[model samples]
Target: MKRDFAVIGLGRFGGSICRELSMEGMEVLAIDIDEDKVNEFKNIASHAVIADSTDEATLKDLGIKNIDHVIVAIGDNIQASILTTVVLTDFNIKKITVKAQNDYHEKILNKIGADQVVHPERDMGKRIAHNIISNNILDYLELSDDHSIVEVKVGAKMLGKSLIDLDIRANYGCNVVAIKQGKDINVSPSAEDKLKEDDILIVIGADKDISRFEKHLVVDE
Candidate 1:
């Protein structure tokens, strides 16, 4: 079944989501107060309209209740973002993801029942910092305040070692959930599966444990 999505913003973040969803064959309704933004996505989304998302009547007339998911990615204007989210919650949308401009905005969105809140700039900054700290740390995803999932490139020290030999879960308190070698990925890598130099390990655990694991196994000696 094709999932129906409505994006209530046409800024960079929202526009990217609209384009990706449309490309993936999902039904997308792209909305923005800017006529130019709406026109730009007219050929990209299932429907594009210039409308104020904070206006309940406008949303109702657009049949927003029929959407399976709604993304409130209004940029800069925290008032509009919160108001749109409040309006969305009233319809009991299956899911509503909002882009938070700051910590205060996030708290308000959460209190008003936003299903998910994203801090894109903050998250990207963390990813970049991790990459700068260690070349082997390819990516970082925070699951919680103290937990994260990291993609680590296998270093020279780990090239010939197998999972059993390293005992990653026991020694580092981290799990190698998957191993990506070039375009192929091993989702269920065995204990005896050996690491290759170019392989990338998807590791998940507490932040401290992941840091230790990265220091010992990922970084070149």
Candidate 2:
């Protein structure tokens, strides 16, 4: 099934999304106020349009109704971003994603009817901070507003214990979705599988539950 996507603003976020969607065999109509940016993505996107996304005429002319998803990626100009999002929603474009510069911007985007609001910079900062805070925590991915996926080392506390013995699901309210042992990975790790000191566990749970799980690894002084 092929889905059509329309992206407003040809900046990094929008441009990257258009490229990816096009690569995935989806038809993407890329839009930007700057002709130069539109030209840059001409080869990558299925189609590129140079127009002010805040203008209703441009959106109507682009055949926004055919688009299954519309992403508003205007940068720096919060007003332009919000205006573009509101216009797209008014046109009844399904699945709108807006880039927000700050908390205030996020709230505005939410109020303006954006299906999703992203804070790329703040999200990256949190991921980096999580990796730096613990040697055990290898990576972190937010699954939803309340849930996340985390990669962590098994460490000594969990060494020599089987999945059933640890009872991670009962204790942590999370599941070990995958196991990474050196270069080898086991998706859907079995309950009978023994955990080693260095095994990397891919866990999925609420953000608060993940925090509590990490704390259990540290020995109290």
Candidate 3:
């Protein structure tokens, strides 16, 4: 099904999402207070409008309630972001993903019933840091302050060792949720499944535990 989306605040973050959604053939309504920003997405988005999203009347007039997901990516202006989110929640919007400026901002957005909150810069920094620290760590996705899901490339250190042999859950306190060997994926991989070089492990656990798993299991090239 083609889901409709409304992205308020046409800054770098919101603009990127608007473009991506449009490219994916999804209907998107791009809203921004600045005329110039709205104009940039005029041809790219299904609808681009210069309107203040925080204003309840403006949002209702644009039929934002019908959109399946709404992303609030208002940059810097915390008040506007919060106000827009409150308005959306009042309208009973299904999913609201907000880009928060800081920890405090994220907390408030959560309290206001935001479906998802993203700290882009902070998260990207952590991802890069993890990649720099290990050659086998392919990607790091933060689930919370404590937990994360990390995709790691199996290396020489773990070659031929089965899940039971390593006892990952007991040893590193992380779970191997899946294993990807080229085009094939073994979801919920069994204990008897052996590691092969270049295989990717989709691991989920506490951040500290994931770090431990990476340090000991993934070979540093």
Candidate 4:
């Protein structure tokens, strides 16, 4: 079943998420105080309306409480974002994800019961910096403050080595969660599996451990 989503504040971040969710065939209700922004997504979203999400009556009228998830994406206006998120929580919405402006804003959101808080600008910068620092890193995803999941291309050093032979977990404190070779992905890759030079290993571990693994085994070979 397609999930129902409500995206508040149709700025760049929220707009992008709304469009992607709609394209994926999910039911999305796009809301914003700006009529122009709401109208821009009229055909794209299941419903688009010009309404301030900070207003509890307006949210109730729109049946927002029944939505599976709500994204508070108010841009620049941190006050409005907090108000909207608080109202959503009061409504007992299943999930609430909020775009935080800074560390202080994120802290407040977390304290107020936001299910997820995203620092898009800061996180993207970290991801891009990591990618540039390591050419072998295909992708980087932050799981928490200290842990991350990275996709690293197998280098010459790792080529033809079985998982057991590498002893990745014991040696570097990282786990090879999956291996991708061309279009095939081995989610349950065995200890006996050997890595090809072209294989991509999806590794998960603490950020420091992943950095150590990448520097020693997946790069400069």
- Candidate 2 local lDDT, residue 178: 89
> For model 3, how does the per-residue alpha-carbon lDDT over 135-203 read when each residue is reduced to its tens digit?
788899998789999998887877889889989899999998999989999897878878888789999
lDDT of 3 at 43: 100
Q: Which stretches of candidate 2 lie over 4 Å from their true place?
A: 180-188, 196-199, 218-221
Candidate 3, after superposition: displacement of residue 207 in Å? 1.7
Each model's TM-score, in the order given?
Answer: 0.95, 0.86, 0.92, 0.94
What is each predicted model's overall lDDT from 0 to 1? 0.94, 0.86, 0.92, 0.93
Off by over 4 Å in 4: none
> Model 3, residue 120: displacement in angstroms?
1.5
List, in order, the clash count of every candidate structure.
0, 0, 0, 0
Residues 1-221 of candidate 4: C-alpha lDDT, one tens digit per residue:
88999999899999999999999999999999999999999999999999988999999999998999999999999999999999999999999999999999999999999999999889888878877876778889999999999998887788899999999999999999999999999999988978887889999999999989988887765
User: Which residue window of length 10 is worst by lDDT in model 4?
Assistant: 129-138
